[model samples]
Target: MSFHKYIFHYRFSGKSDKPLILFLHGFMGNIHEFDEAISLLTDEFYCLNIDLPGHGKTKILDDDCYKMPKIADALINLLNELQIERCFLIGYSMGGRLALYLTLKFPQRFHKIILESASPGLITDRERLERVKRDEQIARKLARSVEKDDFRKFLDNWYNQQIFGNIKNHPHFEQMIENRLQNNPKKLAKSLQLMGTGVQPSLWDKLKENKKPILLLVGENDSKFVEINRKMFAVNQLCKLKIIKKAAHNIHLENTFIFIENIRNFF
Candidate 1:
Protein backbone atom coordinates (compact mmCIF):
# COMPACT_ATOMS: atom_id res chain seq x y z
CA MET A 1 0.00 0.00 0.00
CA SER A 2 1.05 3.59 -0.58
CA PHE A 3 1.41 6.17 2.16
CA HIS A 4 2.86 9.69 1.98
CA LYS A 5 4.20 9.07 -1.52
CA TYR A 6 5.94 5.82 -0.58
CA ILE A 7 4.77 2.38 -1.58
CA PHE A 8 5.10 0.10 1.42
CA HIS A 9 5.35 -3.65 0.96
CA TYR A 10 4.61 -5.67 4.05
CA ARG A 11 4.13 -9.33 4.95
CA PHE A 12 1.78 -10.43 7.69
CA SER A 13 2.26 -13.90 9.14
CA GLY A 14 0.76 -16.06 11.90
CA LYS A 15 -2.69 -15.88 13.49
CA SER A 16 -4.54 -12.59 13.59
CA ASP A 17 -5.50 -12.95 17.24
CA LYS A 18 -1.94 -13.16 18.47
CA PRO A 19 -0.05 -10.13 19.78
CA LEU A 20 1.55 -8.36 16.84
CA ILE A 21 5.29 -7.98 16.42
CA LEU A 22 6.45 -5.49 13.83
CA PHE A 23 9.90 -6.01 12.37
CA LEU A 24 11.88 -3.19 10.74
CA HIS A 25 15.15 -3.97 8.97
CA GLY A 26 18.33 -1.90 8.88
CA PHE A 27 19.85 0.18 6.11
CA MET A 28 20.54 -1.76 2.89
CA GLY A 29 18.10 -4.33 4.25
CA ASN A 30 14.61 -5.55 3.36
CA ILE A 31 11.86 -7.65 4.85
CA HIS A 32 13.80 -10.80 4.01
CA GLU A 33 16.43 -9.76 6.51
CA PHE A 34 14.05 -10.88 9.26
CA ASP A 35 13.05 -14.19 7.65
CA GLU A 36 15.21 -16.40 9.82
CA ALA A 37 14.16 -14.73 13.06
CA ILE A 38 10.52 -14.34 12.10
CA SER A 39 10.32 -18.03 11.26
CA LEU A 40 10.98 -18.74 14.92
CA LEU A 41 8.93 -15.83 16.30
CA THR A 42 5.63 -16.38 14.46
CA ASP A 43 4.75 -19.22 16.82
CA GLU A 44 4.44 -16.76 19.65
CA PHE A 45 3.44 -13.50 17.96
CA TYR A 46 1.93 -12.51 14.67
CA CYS A 47 4.70 -10.81 12.69
CA LEU A 48 4.47 -7.81 10.40
CA ASN A 49 7.61 -7.39 8.33
CA ILE A 50 7.89 -4.32 6.13
CA ASP A 51 10.18 -3.03 3.43
CA LEU A 52 11.03 0.56 4.38
CA PRO A 53 11.30 3.31 1.77
CA GLY A 54 13.93 2.67 -0.93
CA HIS A 55 14.47 -0.89 0.22
CA GLY A 56 13.24 -4.17 -1.26
CA LYS A 57 9.77 -4.02 -2.86
CA THR A 58 8.97 -0.57 -1.44
CA LYS A 59 9.20 2.46 -3.71
CA ILE A 60 10.13 6.02 -2.82
CA LEU A 61 7.46 8.25 -4.29
CA ASP A 62 8.84 11.59 -3.20
CA ASP A 63 12.25 12.65 -1.92
CA ASP A 64 10.69 14.60 0.94
CA CYS A 65 9.15 11.42 2.34
CA TYR A 66 12.61 10.10 3.18
CA LYS A 67 12.82 12.23 6.31
CA MET A 68 12.75 10.12 9.48
CA PRO A 69 9.56 11.59 10.97
CA LYS A 70 7.74 11.28 7.66
CA ILE A 71 8.83 7.65 7.32
CA ALA A 72 7.59 7.00 10.86
CA ASP A 73 4.23 8.57 10.03
CA ALA A 74 4.00 6.47 6.89
CA LEU A 75 4.50 3.32 8.96
CA ILE A 76 1.87 4.50 11.42
CA ASN A 77 -0.53 5.01 8.54
CA LEU A 78 0.34 1.52 7.35
CA LEU A 79 -0.50 0.03 10.73
CA ASN A 80 -3.75 1.94 10.78
CA GLU A 81 -4.59 0.64 7.34
CA LEU A 82 -3.88 -2.90 8.51
CA GLN A 83 -6.05 -2.40 11.60
CA ILE A 84 -3.17 -3.11 13.95
CA GLU A 85 -4.01 -1.15 17.07
CA ARG A 86 -0.72 -1.81 18.81
CA CYS A 87 2.34 -4.01 18.34
CA PHE A 88 5.79 -4.77 19.64
CA LEU A 89 8.52 -3.12 17.59
CA ILE A 90 11.89 -4.70 16.78
CA GLY A 91 14.22 -2.56 14.71
CA TYR A 92 17.78 -3.03 13.55
CA SER A 93 20.25 -0.20 13.08
CA MET A 94 18.70 2.44 10.82
CA GLY A 95 15.33 0.88 11.33
CA GLY A 96 15.93 1.03 15.07
CA ARG A 97 16.43 4.76 14.83
CA LEU A 98 13.15 5.08 12.96
CA ALA A 99 11.44 2.85 15.49
CA LEU A 100 12.71 5.07 18.25
CA TYR A 101 11.35 8.10 16.45
CA LEU A 102 7.97 6.48 15.95
CA THR A 103 7.72 5.34 19.54
CA LEU A 104 8.49 8.84 20.71
CA LYS A 105 5.99 10.41 18.36
CA PHE A 106 3.22 8.00 19.23
CA PRO A 107 4.03 6.43 22.53
CA GLN A 108 0.69 4.72 22.89
CA ARG A 109 0.96 2.85 19.63
CA PHE A 110 3.72 0.49 20.73
CA HIS A 111 3.70 -2.03 23.55
CA LYS A 112 7.46 -2.54 23.64
CA ILE A 113 10.49 -1.66 21.55
CA ILE A 114 13.78 -3.45 20.90
CA LEU A 115 16.56 -1.46 19.27
CA GLU A 116 19.66 -3.15 17.84
CA SER A 117 22.71 -0.98 17.27
CA ALA A 118 20.76 2.28 17.03
CA SER A 119 21.39 5.80 18.33
CA PRO A 120 19.42 8.88 19.33
CA GLY A 121 21.38 11.17 17.01
CA LEU A 122 24.00 13.86 17.78
CA ILE A 123 23.63 15.60 21.12
CA THR A 124 25.12 18.96 20.25
CA ASP A 125 24.66 21.39 17.38
CA ARG A 126 28.36 21.15 16.60
CA GLU A 127 28.16 17.38 16.48
CA ARG A 128 25.03 17.46 14.31
CA LEU A 129 26.59 19.91 11.88
CA GLU A 130 29.78 17.85 11.63
CA ARG A 131 27.81 14.66 11.06
CA VAL A 132 25.68 16.39 8.46
CA LYS A 133 28.76 17.28 6.45
CA ARG A 134 30.19 13.77 6.79
CA ASP A 135 26.91 12.06 5.82
CA GLU A 136 26.44 14.40 2.87
CA GLN A 137 29.86 13.50 1.54
CA ILE A 138 29.12 9.82 1.95
CA ALA A 139 25.71 10.21 0.34
CA ARG A 140 27.20 12.05 -2.62
CA LYS A 141 29.76 9.29 -3.05
CA LEU A 142 26.96 6.71 -3.01
CA ALA A 143 25.01 8.76 -5.55
CA ARG A 144 27.99 8.85 -7.87
CA SER A 145 28.49 5.12 -7.50
CA VAL A 146 24.83 4.61 -8.35
CA GLU A 147 25.12 6.88 -11.38
CA LYS A 148 28.11 4.78 -12.48
CA ASP A 149 26.13 1.59 -11.82
CA ASP A 150 28.91 0.38 -9.52
CA PHE A 151 26.53 -1.16 -6.98
CA ARG A 152 28.77 -4.07 -6.17
CA LYS A 153 31.61 -1.69 -5.37
CA PHE A 154 29.31 0.36 -3.17
CA LEU A 155 28.11 -2.75 -1.32
CA ASP A 156 31.70 -3.89 -0.88
CA ASN A 157 32.70 -0.54 0.56
CA TRP A 158 29.67 -0.46 2.87
CA TYR A 159 30.20 -3.90 4.40
CA ASN A 160 33.96 -3.48 4.64
CA GLN A 161 33.53 -1.07 7.54
CA GLN A 162 35.36 -2.31 10.62
CA ILE A 163 32.08 -2.67 12.49
CA PHE A 164 31.09 -5.51 10.16
CA GLY A 165 34.45 -7.30 10.33
CA ASN A 166 32.96 -10.10 12.38
CA ILE A 167 30.36 -10.99 9.74
CA LYS A 168 32.64 -10.75 6.69
CA ASN A 169 33.36 -14.47 6.71
CA HIS A 170 29.95 -15.76 7.71
CA PRO A 171 28.47 -18.41 5.38
CA HIS A 172 25.55 -16.08 4.63
CA PHE A 173 27.78 -13.17 3.69
CA GLU A 174 27.39 -13.74 -0.03
CA GLN A 175 23.63 -14.04 0.30
CA MET A 176 23.54 -10.85 2.29
CA ILE A 177 25.41 -9.02 -0.46
CA GLU A 178 23.02 -10.41 -3.05
CA ASN A 179 20.01 -9.16 -1.12
CA ARG A 180 21.48 -5.66 -0.76
CA LEU A 181 22.19 -5.53 -4.48
CA GLN A 182 18.45 -5.74 -5.18
CA ASN A 183 17.90 -2.24 -3.79
CA ASN A 184 17.43 0.71 -6.15
CA PRO A 185 20.58 2.76 -5.91
CA LYS A 186 18.89 6.06 -6.70
CA LYS A 187 16.37 5.53 -3.94
CA LEU A 188 19.08 4.44 -1.51
CA ALA A 189 21.09 7.57 -2.18
CA LYS A 190 18.03 9.72 -1.60
CA SER A 191 17.23 7.85 1.60
CA LEU A 192 20.69 8.57 2.93
CA GLN A 193 20.54 12.21 1.93
CA LEU A 194 17.21 12.72 3.64
CA MET A 195 17.11 10.25 6.52
CA GLY A 196 20.71 10.00 7.60
CA THR A 197 21.35 10.30 11.34
CA GLY A 198 22.93 13.69 10.75
CA VAL A 199 19.60 15.13 9.70
CA GLN A 200 17.52 13.32 12.32
CA PRO A 201 16.44 15.26 15.37
CA SER A 202 18.37 14.31 18.49
CA LEU A 203 16.11 12.29 20.75
CA TRP A 204 18.53 12.11 23.66
CA ASP A 205 16.34 14.39 25.76
CA LYS A 206 13.29 12.30 25.00
CA LEU A 207 14.83 9.14 26.43
CA LYS A 208 13.63 9.86 29.93
CA GLU A 209 10.12 10.58 28.70
CA ASN A 210 9.56 7.10 27.31
CA LYS A 211 7.39 5.00 29.53
CA LYS A 212 7.28 1.82 27.46
CA PRO A 213 9.77 -1.00 27.99
CA ILE A 214 12.85 -0.74 25.79
CA LEU A 215 15.49 -3.37 25.16
CA LEU A 216 18.68 -1.95 23.68
CA LEU A 217 20.88 -4.58 22.04
CA VAL A 218 24.41 -3.92 20.93
CA GLY A 219 27.31 -6.08 19.84
CA GLU A 220 30.15 -6.19 22.35
CA ASN A 221 32.62 -5.53 19.59
CA ASP A 222 30.81 -2.47 18.27
CA SER A 223 32.21 -0.07 20.84
CA LYS A 224 30.59 3.04 19.41
CA PHE A 225 27.00 1.84 19.64
CA VAL A 226 27.76 -0.06 22.88
CA GLU A 227 28.60 3.24 24.56
CA ILE A 228 25.60 4.92 22.96
CA ASN A 229 23.15 2.33 24.25
CA ARG A 230 24.84 2.39 27.65
CA LYS A 231 24.09 6.11 27.95
CA MET A 232 20.54 5.38 26.78
CA PHE A 233 20.02 2.78 29.51
CA ALA A 234 21.45 5.02 32.18
CA VAL A 235 18.82 7.71 31.61
CA ASN A 236 15.79 5.44 31.31
CA GLN A 237 15.22 2.99 34.12
CA LEU A 238 12.80 1.04 31.91
CA CYS A 239 15.56 0.55 29.34
CA LYS A 240 17.75 -2.58 29.40
CA LEU A 241 21.07 -2.93 27.61
CA LYS A 242 22.14 -6.38 26.43
CA ILE A 243 25.55 -6.87 24.89
CA ILE A 244 25.98 -9.88 22.65
CA LYS A 245 29.42 -11.26 23.55
CA LYS A 246 30.89 -12.37 20.22
CA ALA A 247 29.15 -10.13 17.72
CA ALA A 248 29.57 -6.80 15.97
CA HIS A 249 27.16 -4.36 14.35
CA ASN A 250 25.04 -6.91 12.54
CA ILE A 251 24.39 -9.14 15.52
CA HIS A 252 21.26 -10.67 14.02
CA LEU A 253 23.33 -12.12 11.17
CA GLU A 254 26.58 -12.72 13.07
CA ASN A 255 25.03 -14.19 16.20
CA THR A 256 21.65 -15.42 15.03
CA PHE A 257 21.02 -17.83 17.89
CA ILE A 258 21.73 -15.34 20.61
CA PHE A 259 19.83 -12.60 18.76
CA ILE A 260 16.72 -14.71 18.46
CA GLU A 261 17.00 -15.84 22.08
CA ASN A 262 17.27 -12.23 23.24
CA ILE A 263 14.14 -11.22 21.32
CA ARG A 264 12.23 -14.19 22.70
CA ASN A 265 13.16 -13.34 26.25
CA PHE A 266 12.66 -9.60 25.90
CA PHE A 267 9.13 -9.74 24.57
Candidate 2:
Protein backbone atom coordinates (compact mmCIF):
# COMPACT_ATOMS: atom_id res chain seq x y z
CA MET A 1 0.00 0.00 0.00
CA SER A 2 0.93 3.69 -0.13
CA PHE A 3 3.32 4.77 2.59
CA HIS A 4 4.32 8.37 1.90
CA LYS A 5 6.83 8.41 -0.98
CA TYR A 6 6.81 4.68 -1.60
CA ILE A 7 4.20 2.14 -2.60
CA PHE A 8 5.14 -1.06 -0.76
CA HIS A 9 4.15 -4.66 -1.30
CA TYR A 10 3.75 -6.13 2.18
CA ARG A 11 2.20 -9.16 3.86
CA PHE A 12 0.99 -9.50 7.45
CA SER A 13 0.39 -12.90 9.04
CA GLY A 14 -0.59 -14.52 12.34
CA LYS A 15 -2.59 -12.95 15.17
CA SER A 16 -2.36 -9.22 15.80
CA ASP A 17 -2.39 -9.84 19.55
CA LYS A 18 0.92 -11.67 19.30
CA PRO A 19 4.20 -9.76 19.49
CA LEU A 20 5.00 -8.38 16.04
CA ILE A 21 8.23 -9.07 14.19
CA LEU A 22 9.05 -6.96 11.17
CA PHE A 23 11.29 -8.75 8.67
CA LEU A 24 13.52 -7.06 6.12
CA HIS A 25 14.91 -9.14 3.27
CA GLY A 26 18.39 -9.05 1.75
CA PHE A 27 19.41 -7.60 -1.58
CA MET A 28 17.61 -9.37 -4.46
CA GLY A 29 15.16 -10.81 -1.91
CA ASN A 30 11.44 -10.07 -1.71
CA ILE A 31 8.73 -10.07 0.96
CA HIS A 32 8.71 -13.88 0.84
CA GLU A 33 12.38 -14.09 1.79
CA PHE A 34 11.52 -15.38 5.26
CA ASP A 35 8.49 -17.47 4.31
CA GLU A 36 9.87 -20.75 5.66
CA ALA A 37 10.95 -19.20 8.95
CA ILE A 38 7.77 -17.16 9.34
CA SER A 39 5.64 -20.29 8.77
CA LEU A 40 7.12 -21.85 11.90
CA LEU A 41 7.00 -18.65 13.95
CA THR A 42 3.38 -17.72 13.28
CA ASP A 43 2.29 -19.69 16.33
CA GLU A 44 4.36 -17.41 18.54
CA PHE A 45 4.69 -14.10 16.74
CA TYR A 46 2.88 -11.94 14.26
CA CYS A 47 4.95 -11.28 11.09
CA LEU A 48 5.17 -8.36 8.72
CA ASN A 49 7.25 -8.71 5.56
CA ILE A 50 7.66 -6.18 2.80
CA ASP A 51 9.45 -5.60 -0.48
CA LEU A 52 11.94 -2.77 -0.13
CA PRO A 53 12.44 -0.17 -2.85
CA GLY A 54 13.72 -1.37 -6.24
CA HIS A 55 12.76 -4.94 -5.38
CA GLY A 56 9.55 -6.95 -5.92
CA LYS A 57 6.38 -4.96 -6.63
CA THR A 58 7.26 -1.95 -4.49
CA LYS A 59 7.36 1.32 -6.46
CA ILE A 60 9.48 4.26 -5.50
CA LEU A 61 8.15 7.73 -6.24
CA ASP A 62 11.58 9.35 -5.94
CA ASP A 63 15.09 8.21 -6.67
CA ASP A 64 16.14 9.69 -3.31
CA CYS A 65 14.13 6.93 -1.68
CA TYR A 66 16.95 4.60 -2.72
CA LYS A 67 19.22 6.22 -0.16
CA MET A 68 19.57 4.36 3.16
CA PRO A 69 18.44 7.21 5.41
CA LYS A 70 15.41 7.88 3.23
CA ILE A 71 14.55 4.20 3.18
CA ALA A 72 14.80 4.16 6.99
CA ASP A 73 12.48 7.15 7.22
CA ALA A 74 10.06 5.45 4.83
CA LEU A 75 10.00 2.33 7.01
CA ILE A 76 9.38 4.36 10.17
CA ASN A 77 6.59 6.15 8.37
CA LEU A 78 5.17 2.75 7.46
CA LEU A 79 5.25 1.59 11.08
CA ASN A 80 3.41 4.76 12.16
CA GLU A 81 0.81 4.23 9.43
CA LEU A 82 0.27 0.70 10.67
CA GLN A 83 -0.12 1.95 14.24
CA ILE A 84 2.70 -0.28 15.46
CA GLU A 85 4.33 1.51 18.38
CA ARG A 86 7.10 -0.99 18.89
CA CYS A 87 8.05 -4.39 17.44
CA PHE A 88 10.76 -7.00 17.09
CA LEU A 89 12.99 -7.00 13.99
CA ILE A 90 14.76 -9.62 11.87
CA GLY A 91 17.04 -8.49 9.05
CA TYR A 92 19.25 -10.49 6.71
CA SER A 93 22.35 -9.12 4.96
CA MET A 94 21.48 -5.73 3.47
CA GLY A 95 18.35 -5.67 5.58
CA GLY A 96 20.46 -6.36 8.63
CA ARG A 97 22.56 -3.27 7.94
CA LEU A 98 19.42 -1.19 7.54
CA ALA A 99 17.94 -2.76 10.67
CA LEU A 100 21.03 -1.74 12.61
CA TYR A 101 20.67 1.80 11.27
CA LEU A 102 17.02 1.87 12.30
CA THR A 103 17.81 0.52 15.75
CA LEU A 104 20.51 3.07 16.33
CA LYS A 105 18.65 5.95 14.69
CA PHE A 106 15.26 5.31 16.28
CA PRO A 107 15.96 3.12 19.29
CA GLN A 108 12.56 3.55 20.93
CA ARG A 109 10.62 2.06 18.04
CA PHE A 110 12.12 -1.43 18.31
CA HIS A 111 11.96 -3.87 21.21
CA LYS A 112 14.74 -6.19 19.98
CA ILE A 113 16.64 -7.01 16.81
CA ILE A 114 18.13 -10.04 15.05
CA LEU A 115 20.82 -9.57 12.41
CA GLU A 116 21.88 -12.55 10.23
CA SER A 117 25.05 -12.52 8.15
CA ALA A 118 25.17 -8.74 8.60
CA SER A 119 27.83 -6.08 9.02
CA PRO A 120 28.02 -2.44 10.10
CA GLY A 121 29.29 -1.43 6.63
CA LEU A 122 32.89 -0.65 5.65
CA ILE A 123 35.01 1.18 8.21
CA THR A 124 37.14 3.29 5.88
CA ASP A 125 36.54 5.77 3.10
CA ARG A 126 38.89 3.92 0.75
CA GLU A 127 37.05 0.66 1.38
CA ARG A 128 33.69 2.26 0.74
CA LEU A 129 34.88 3.86 -2.51
CA GLU A 130 36.34 0.56 -3.73
CA ARG A 131 33.15 -1.28 -2.86
CA VAL A 132 31.07 1.32 -4.64
CA LYS A 133 33.06 0.75 -7.81
CA ARG A 134 32.72 -3.01 -7.50
CA ASP A 135 28.96 -2.71 -6.90
CA GLU A 136 28.69 -0.49 -9.95
CA GLN A 137 30.28 -3.16 -12.12
CA ILE A 138 27.93 -5.79 -10.68
CA ALA A 139 24.97 -3.49 -11.23
CA ARG A 140 25.93 -3.14 -14.87
CA LYS A 141 25.95 -6.91 -15.20
CA LEU A 142 22.55 -7.20 -13.56
CA ALA A 143 21.16 -4.47 -15.77
CA ARG A 144 22.43 -6.27 -18.86
CA SER A 145 20.97 -9.63 -17.87
CA VAL A 146 17.54 -8.97 -19.31
CA GLU A 147 16.80 -12.47 -20.55
CA LYS A 148 15.76 -15.40 -18.34
CA ASP A 149 18.77 -17.51 -19.30
CA ASP A 150 21.14 -14.60 -18.75
CA PHE A 151 19.64 -13.91 -15.34
CA ARG A 152 19.90 -17.62 -14.48
CA LYS A 153 23.55 -17.56 -15.39
CA PHE A 154 24.06 -14.50 -13.23
CA LEU A 155 22.29 -16.20 -10.31
CA ASP A 156 24.43 -19.31 -10.66
CA ASN A 157 27.59 -17.26 -10.61
CA TRP A 158 26.35 -15.26 -7.62
CA TYR A 159 25.77 -18.25 -5.34
CA ASN A 160 29.21 -19.53 -6.28
CA GLN A 161 30.70 -16.80 -4.07
CA GLN A 162 32.53 -18.36 -1.14
CA ILE A 163 30.52 -16.18 1.23
CA PHE A 164 27.48 -18.24 0.18
CA GLY A 165 29.38 -21.50 0.86
CA ASN A 166 27.64 -24.61 -0.54
CA ILE A 167 24.19 -23.14 -1.08
CA LYS A 168 24.35 -24.34 -4.68
CA ASN A 169 24.18 -27.93 -3.45
CA HIS A 170 20.99 -27.45 -1.48
CA PRO A 171 17.99 -29.40 -2.79
CA HIS A 172 15.89 -26.30 -3.14
CA PHE A 173 18.63 -24.25 -4.77
CA GLU A 174 16.89 -24.28 -8.11
CA GLN A 175 13.61 -23.17 -6.55
CA MET A 176 15.35 -20.37 -4.73
CA ILE A 177 16.84 -19.14 -7.99
CA GLU A 178 13.41 -19.29 -9.59
CA ASN A 179 11.94 -17.13 -6.87
CA ARG A 180 14.79 -14.62 -7.23
CA LEU A 181 14.13 -14.54 -10.96
CA GLN A 182 10.82 -12.86 -10.23
CA ASN A 183 12.72 -9.64 -9.48
CA ASN A 184 13.51 -7.28 -12.33
CA PRO A 185 17.23 -7.17 -12.98
CA LYS A 186 17.07 -3.50 -13.91
CA LYS A 187 15.49 -2.51 -10.65
CA LEU A 188 17.70 -4.88 -8.71
CA ALA A 189 20.65 -3.09 -10.27
CA LYS A 190 19.28 0.23 -9.09
CA SER A 191 18.98 -1.10 -5.55
CA LEU A 192 22.51 -2.44 -5.64
CA GLN A 193 23.86 0.86 -6.90
CA LEU A 194 22.06 2.96 -4.30
CA MET A 195 21.50 0.84 -1.17
CA GLY A 196 24.54 -1.39 -1.40
CA THR A 197 26.88 -1.68 1.59
CA GLY A 198 29.16 0.94 0.09
CA VAL A 199 26.40 3.51 0.28
CA GLN A 200 25.46 2.87 3.94
CA PRO A 201 27.20 4.87 6.66
CA SER A 202 29.34 2.67 8.89
CA LEU A 203 27.63 1.78 12.16
CA TRP A 204 30.77 0.51 13.90
CA ASP A 205 31.14 3.65 16.02
CA LYS A 206 27.46 3.61 16.99
CA LEU A 207 27.58 -0.06 18.01
CA LYS A 208 29.20 0.72 21.36
CA GLU A 209 26.36 3.09 22.24
CA ASN A 210 23.46 0.72 21.63
CA LYS A 211 21.35 -0.40 24.62
CA LYS A 212 18.66 -2.50 22.96
CA PRO A 213 18.92 -6.27 23.12
CA ILE A 214 20.61 -7.40 19.90
CA LEU A 215 21.08 -10.91 18.54
CA LEU A 216 23.75 -11.48 15.90
CA LEU A 217 23.37 -14.69 13.86
CA VAL A 218 26.11 -15.77 11.49
CA GLY A 219 26.65 -19.08 9.73
CA GLU A 220 29.62 -21.12 10.93
CA ASN A 221 30.82 -21.56 7.38
CA ASP A 222 30.61 -17.85 6.73
CA SER A 223 33.92 -16.98 8.36
CA LYS A 224 33.84 -13.38 7.15
CA PHE A 225 30.62 -12.45 8.90
CA VAL A 226 31.47 -14.58 11.93
CA GLU A 227 34.56 -12.44 12.46
CA ILE A 228 32.54 -9.29 11.85
CA ASN A 229 29.90 -10.27 14.39
CA ARG A 230 32.61 -11.27 16.82
CA LYS A 231 33.96 -7.72 16.66
CA MET A 232 30.45 -6.40 17.08
CA PHE A 233 29.96 -8.55 20.19
CA ALA A 234 33.29 -7.38 21.60
CA VAL A 235 32.17 -3.76 21.40
CA ASN A 236 28.63 -4.08 22.74
CA GLN A 237 27.73 -5.60 26.11
CA LEU A 238 24.06 -6.06 25.21
CA CYS A 239 24.74 -7.87 21.91
CA LYS A 240 24.68 -11.66 21.71
CA LEU A 241 26.27 -13.62 18.88
CA LYS A 242 25.21 -17.10 17.79
CA ILE A 243 27.05 -18.90 15.03
CA ILE A 244 24.84 -21.38 13.17
CA LYS A 245 26.63 -24.65 12.50
CA LYS A 246 27.11 -25.98 8.95
CA ALA A 247 25.45 -23.03 7.28
CA ALA A 248 26.80 -20.12 5.24
CA HIS A 249 25.78 -16.56 4.46
CA ASN A 250 22.14 -17.38 3.89
CA ILE A 251 21.50 -19.30 7.09
CA HIS A 252 17.71 -19.10 7.00
CA LEU A 253 17.63 -20.84 3.63
CA GLU A 254 20.53 -23.21 4.22
CA ASN A 255 19.36 -24.39 7.64
CA THR A 256 15.81 -23.32 8.25
CA PHE A 257 15.24 -25.37 11.42
CA ILE A 258 18.27 -24.09 13.28
CA PHE A 259 17.61 -20.56 12.07
CA ILE A 260 14.09 -20.74 13.48
CA GLU A 261 15.44 -22.22 16.71
CA ASN A 262 17.76 -19.24 17.15
CA ILE A 263 14.89 -16.83 16.49
CA ARG A 264 12.73 -18.65 19.07
CA ASN A 265 15.46 -18.54 21.69
CA PHE A 266 16.55 -14.98 20.95
CA PHE A 267 13.19 -13.30 20.54
lDDT of each: 0.86, 0.93
Question: All candidates' TM-scores?
Answer: 0.95, 0.98
The 10-residue segment of model 2 with minimum total lDDT is 1-10
1-267 in candidate 2: lDDT tens per residue?
676789888999999999999999999899889988899999999999999998889999877888899999989989998999999999999999999999999999999999999999999999999999999999999999999999999999998898999999999888788889999999999899999999889999999999899999999999899999999999999999999998999999999999999888888
Which predicted model would earn the best TM-score? 2
Q: Candidate 2, overall lDDT?
A: 0.93
lDDT of 1: 0.86
Regions of model 2 farther than 4 Å from truth: none
Clashing residue pairs in candidate 2 are none
User: Poorest 10 consecutive residues of model 1 by lDDT?
Assistant: 140-149
Q: What is the lDDT, from 0 to 100, of the residue 140 in candidate 1?
A: 79
RMSD of each: 1.5, 0.8
